[model samples]
Target: MNGDAVRVLTYNVRRDVASDGEFDWAARRDAVASTLRFHRPDVIGLQEPLAHQYADVRDALPAYEWVGQSRNADDGDGEFCPVGYRRDRFERVDAGTFWLSPTPEEPGSVGWDAAYPRIATWVRLEYRRSGERLLYANTHLDHESARARAEGAELLRERVQEQRENDEALVVGGDLNCLAGDEPHRALAGPDEESPLVDAREASPHPPHGPSTTRTDFEGLLPDRQIDHVFVAGCDVAGYGVAADVMGDGWFPSDHLPVVVDLEL
Candidate 1:
């Protein structure tokens, strides 16, 4: 990697569920780690992982450290959206989580017309090599409610605007459950001039690699459901891709493919 470049990956690991059968976490844990290891991301944002599931990945990637909390509990008991970074390369300045609701500070608060409570995890890090700081956030939006997703996007935008210091580079990523032209995407990366971020894929000079869509459903991939994305500010997108890696058994690591972006900060 170049001195100014950092690779970021956004993935939805799909919470451990027995109903997943052959694709269960116990069966694919190593595959998930292998995929991540192969990509060698400097920073990662993961969605839909329970505590145990996150722990499994954490164990495999010894170089990474993370910050996250469950959407349902302050003690980290439920599903989580976690942001992780290379500990040897970056020193964490601060970290926290906030619910995607009207009462953002209230843990487990449900927002809008959503069926489930959602949250975003964030971290402020200083790159050890360059001494540059970055504010990175990760989230999972409600799949069942358009209103919830749109409002959640606005809340994230507001928080990013409020917390950013001296225009330090910003990166926010997750399973937004919306397409490129969707309201939530528009809210974050707008045709309007005031948007704080832009889609990394759109900013890259080279075309994206791998499949156009990001969801695989374990059984097969869909053509139009590219819900995973990374948005950035004050950086240049050097490369972007959708990773469709699989284990030797031919099973994908999770239901959703990982989205990767190489950024020059």
Candidate 2:
């Protein structure tokens, strides 16, 4: 990559109230911070972070600046799919959040048969040294609604295409809640790798390490459902993998493992 490589990581940190038993936010927050510190991705996107969890990460990783609010509202207390980037390495010139529904501009709106509201947070990052712009879109699809997942995929694809029209490199990360054989995954990736867009894991030059599973329930063992992913366009995938590391006492950083991808833009 000749020093043009950039690392991106996507994680669903598992909200505050939902974490069961020993996996409480207090017990795992530092482990999450340590994971971020160990990998040191240039850009990171997080999903399902409660207000206090967000505050903890923001405080722990002061080197990065972030933008995002709850999917529910601008000033509400709910899950957030926040995106953060290294301030010394890139400048976040612009960013915004939109619901993944028929009325995308309306916050807290639900689409189709979605059980709950879904949202996508996007940002424009200008690489400090290269001066090239990158568009990063982070989202969480409805976990229970097939129709909502499919339709939300189409909506996000349109947004990515709109930004692609400007010729900026694109990276989409999320807890898609759809698997490899699912139609929604196909919709985002088109027919295959021959299509314009490609899944980072599929395009990686180096084989991804660890199990394919990303949802762990914070037990430290990788499960079999690999619903989370990073999709890329206009960039070369240098490497991709599922991070399976854990902190002391068999504690996982989150219920869902973070997916990491290296790109040469």
Candidate 3:
């Protein structure tokens, strides 16, 4: 890293249209575009990226190079995780997706108690500043399964350990659906010699009950949970924060706020 740090962001854009039925598809697209433009992260990890949704984001930000893989075992529509990066800032060295199952090879495979298929998308990015490389992994955990969440966390740890053999920085981010001080977070925060994962949420600017990382507008001011997170390893994280895009019109870019982090490779 030419002595300059890189900024990374993770956002889980709700795939469905608004429940209020006020904003059309175009409005939703524009909202997302505006949010991304305002943040301008070096690398972005997005969840619930459908085919059309991915195209919309790409069209809005043409300068970004992107890659995505479906999580549905049946290969049907629904939700998928997609990652995008600034073409000039980072070069993709490698990328792939694996199911959150004991036997991950079987595509569209379902894991224990998982309501739907789950996957983790990983990419090796080379930072232009210092010529340093880092591995990034993004995923959305199953909302309904305890076993899936625990196993998924272990799987991610194993995957990161394997990738660390390459001697690169590591970062993992997504809507884990697990709260602070949970088992899943504990698994990712385990000790390691080369790269120990650290939770960026705990290091955020907001204090408890100030500005939460996520808010469910489904009900009137529903109980908030810090489900979304960003974890870093093998890199020096300068700072991190959650983007509260709640506008005066009571509209947000997504249900979950985007988490941003500045890191030195």
Question: How accurate locally, in lDDT, is each candidate?
Answer: 0.92, 0.87, 0.78
Candidate 2 per-residue C-alpha lDDT over 81-158 given as tens digits, one digit per residue, 9 for 90 to 100: 999999988998889988999999888898899988899999999999988888999999999999999999888988
Best by TM-score: 1
lDDT of 3 by residue, 1-265 (tens): 3365888889887775656365435556778788888988988999986778878898999989987678876653668888899989888888888888887777888877899888888888887766789889999998988888988888887877787746578889998889867878788875534337888655445442225646545222335677888888777777777777655466776667778887777
Instruction: Sort the predicted structures by lDDT, highest score first.
Output: 1, 2, 3
* Candidate 1 residue-pair clash tally: 0
TM-score between candidate 3 and the true structure: 0.89
TM-score (C-alpha) between model 2 and the true structure: 0.95
Clashes of each: 0, 0, 5
Give residue 216's lDDT in candidate 1 (0 to 100): 86
Q: For model 2, which pairs clash?
A: none
